[model samples]
Target: MSEQFHAFQTEGEGTGSLVKRTVEDLPQGEVLIKVHYSGVNYKDGLALHKKAKIAKDYPMIPGIDLAGTVEHSDSPDFSKGQQVICTSYDLGTAHDGGYSQYARVPAAWVVSLPDNLSLKESMIIGTAGFTAALSIHRLEQNGLTPEDKPILVTGASGGVGSMAVDMLSGRGYHVTASTGRLEEEAYLKKLGAEEVVGREDVTPEKIRPLDKQKWAAAVDPTGGKVLAAILSNVKQHGSVAVSGLTAGVEVPTTVMPFILRGVDLLGIDSAYCPMPLRKEVWSRCAGSLKPRHMEETATEISLNGLQQALNDILESKIRGRVIVNLQK
Candidate 1:
């Protein structure tokens, strides 16, 4: 019998289809992982649904987050049977990624799984969780603290936003979650949001360079108008850490907030983050920054269910994180 495994590959541009793949078909790498879990992110949704051109290569496998054990290794630093995680750094884009049952990744892109996090738990906290943790890390490094006034988390129902809410709130920060889906108010509160506001509350009818001071800081993933509004309302010397552009990239605002309020707009780039900082952030995610409501913040789906889950995420129907169980 042929030694084969299942993978979802895109032949051209649109949605990829599942097919059998042999080990030889994988990209060159030092470590080959028998992937146990992966996660669906917003970028995965856009790429899979053809809403955005995310994959740099046509025959791409679109899963930016993977966690499993090393089945084989050519690097002296890694040994077979060692658990690891590979995320970002071109995975699922310029390089083949974790959508398959097996993934061959450069040893440099892999991190030994933190002792406290399980494979399934790691995928639940995948890229989205990591982005959230990095955002908070940067903000705190810029002087944000739990004693400050409420921190507004935009797009609170989505994965990054939800994780931000949970993690920030877990650390004793006063969290005010804002979402277009007002019906999820109960859900956001459950994730530790002290307050839940409607999207319209955050996106004003007309944005000013500065507005009434509302939040001490903000974790904004939606970007665009929501970011513009948050910038206007952040208190003096506060910061806004932005990670995603789901609401579009344009920010139509002046520099009054930066000049007068001294607000810092910190950009978070989870992909290609220096390995040292990346490992530090991952360690924090497995430690102090880990979401207390993690189990409530994620749902598991099989590889076969990815197509629909991708569409749901793009349509803003997914709440929290969605993990892919390769064994299923």
Candidate 2:
């Protein structure tokens, strides 16, 4: 008989409830991982909501990021007992994902765990941190440097925002973090934010076509009026790397920032990012870009606690990262 394990599967309802599964139940893949840790992300939160339409089908697992050791492999690139991580692509959305004791994924979707990073630590950084690193990487590619003026990170208390703030500051950039929760000001500062501002401060009543230039560049995970506002205020020749749309899908802005100031609004697509760039970013995350406050930014939970955590993430009640420990 195939081995049986517990997994969070969504059926014909709101968010899927937990159910018992087996190795034979997983989708087609070349790699089988003994999942150790997975991180909760805003995408995972939305995936649990049936009406959100983040999943391609029912009975799918919702974790977008997972790190563990290999149990079996059909490809020579990975061997049994090797540490690895799987994120992005179709793992959590269209395929069986990491919200389980075990997961089988395509070998192409996997990355060898970089040295100096533990499996738990990799999950702590997860997809959110990967997106954050990608944002910084894109900005730097467009000529952004630490000597430039204040670098803004919106949604400062959440996963991507928190990681960006910590990583940017650690790289010698002066970071200004913005959040709706003024109560988390000290927390943001603790993560290396040089300045913390209220969400309302960035979302002005009426965003002008060309507002006064403020930041040299920005890493924005909250797209909407906040993104519009940020674009309007970026310094001449500056760039903005946007990765999320939690604020809303619609962005009300104009060409003035782009045409007049030569501003660049770079879209960050963490999903389906080419494997070469994905591996490079993960390397940085495990190296110089790794957040110094990683442990402090993560809240560990067990499989039994996933439902509540997903609900909290959608309600914006979660702070920093939430890592699910399968062994627990």
Candidate 3:
């Protein structure tokens, strides 16, 4: 008998299909996971794009995140039937990933799912939420606190931005959500943003060496011009944590913000985060860092519904998180 499971397979030649693949066909790994939930991310959307160069190889399954019960394990660190999560670090890039009903992951890449988070909830807090948490953690590390000045979040209607807004607001920060989707102002306010501004509000009309300092700090996942504007606008001794490149990649700005204002530019990379820090942050996600509206921040979808979700994410039409519920 052969071990068979359903998976979304993408070819390097730029085509994708849902097919039945055998366990023997997956990449080498020590643990076999019975995936309960996965999450869609910007990277997952790009993995389907013909020119994105995201997937490291052909025949990839690009889900980037999953939470599940362990079906088999060769590593002593994890036991069969234990709940676990696998996200980033080549899961959906170079290796077989979470879009499948079953996934095999290297033990080194797995984490025990935090106690207070269910499989569904964990997937809701997937890569995007993790990135947000890491961003906030880095900001606070750099001496950012909830003060009179607000913390600005770019792309605030999207997953990372929305999560950043919720977490910052929950922690008593005055949050200013910057987004092109002004129609989502009510929703952003509901998530605790004190102010919601148009994306153009943060993006400068032209690149200035420096601007009048406004925000105490910012969480900017929309790199490019928006990031440059943020770099220039952050207060003296402030910090801006950046994660994505949704906008154009070129940053047309001068160095005066960092040198003169003493602002810090922090990079948030959740994918290859150190294991110790990853565990600590996950614990925070289950504890004090957990947001008030995680449920409202996410919507669940079945595997068959992934294509539309992928398209929506790529077009920036999707809001908040899209959790994937795998079917056996």
Candidate 4:
């Protein structure tokens, strides 16, 4: 008989409820990983929504990120006892994901954990950190520079936002962080934000065709009216890298920012990103771009603790990162 291991499974029509799972029920794949840690994300919370549109099928796992040691593999590129990380792609969506004691993934979806990063450390950074790194990479690709005034990071109390502030500041870019959680102002500053502002500072009651140029660039994870406001006020020739829609998906705005000021809106999708780029970004997360005091960014939980964790994420009551420890 195949050994059975516990997994957080979601099933039925509508939004699936939390349930237990077995390894033998997982889809066939080239790699079998003994998961050590999994990270909770905003996307994972949406997967629980009846209309989330994130999980393509029922009975799916909802974790988008995991770090572990290989237990078995059909491909020579991976081996037993090797450390690796998997995020985005079909994981936690169309296939079995990281909300389990074990996970089997395609060899192509795996990246060996970079040097100097532990399995727990990788998950602590998780998908949020990866997306933050990608946002900065895109901004720099579009000509954003540290010398170009101050950069802005919206939703700065959350995982991706906090990571962006830390990474940008680590690279010598002055970051102005914006958040509704004013209580976290000191915390954001500790993460290297040169300035911390209230969410209202970036949110405009009346969005004009254009507003006074404020930021050289911005990393925005909360897209909606605030994005429209940010776009209207971005400096000439500046760019905005957007990765989330926690504020809702619709963005109401005009083209003046793009047409007159040459402002570029860069979209960031960590999932489905090409493997070459994925490897490069993770490498940076392990190196110069790694944030200081990373352990301070996460709250560890056990496998049985996912429900409350997911609920907190949906309500936006959780701060920083939430890591699930399978061994617990």
When 2 and 4 are scored with lDDT, the better candidate is 2
Distance from true location, Cα of 116 in model 4, Å? 1.5
Better of 1 and 3 by lDDT: 1
Over 74-185, each residue of candidate 1 has an lDDT whose tens digit, in order, gives: 9988899999999998899878888999999999999999979999989999999999999999999999999997999999999999999999988999999999999999
Ordered from best to worst TM-score, the candidate numbers read 2, 1, 3, 4
Q: For candidate 4, which ten residues in a row score worst on lDDT?
A: 12-21
CA error at residue 177 for candidate 2, angstroms? 0.4
Winning model by TM-score = 2
User: How well is each residue in 191-267 modelled by candidate 4, as lDDT tens digits?
Assistant: 89989998888997787879999999999999998899999999999999999999878999998999999999999
Per-model TM against the reference: 0.98, 0.98, 0.97, 0.96
**Which regions of candidate 3 fall more than 4 Å away from where they truly are?**
1-3, 12-15
Per-residue CA lDDT of candidate 2, range 133-190, in tens? 9999999999999999799999999999999999999999999999999899999999
- Our tally of clashes for model 4 stands at 0
List of clashing residue pairs for candidate 4: none
Q: Measured by TM-score, how close is model 2 to the native structure? A: 0.98
lDDT of 3 by residue, 11-110 (tens): 7554467899887877889998989999999999899865898987777888899999998899999999999999999999889789998888899999
Model 1 ranges off by over 4 Å: 49-51
Better of 1 and 4 by TM-score: 1
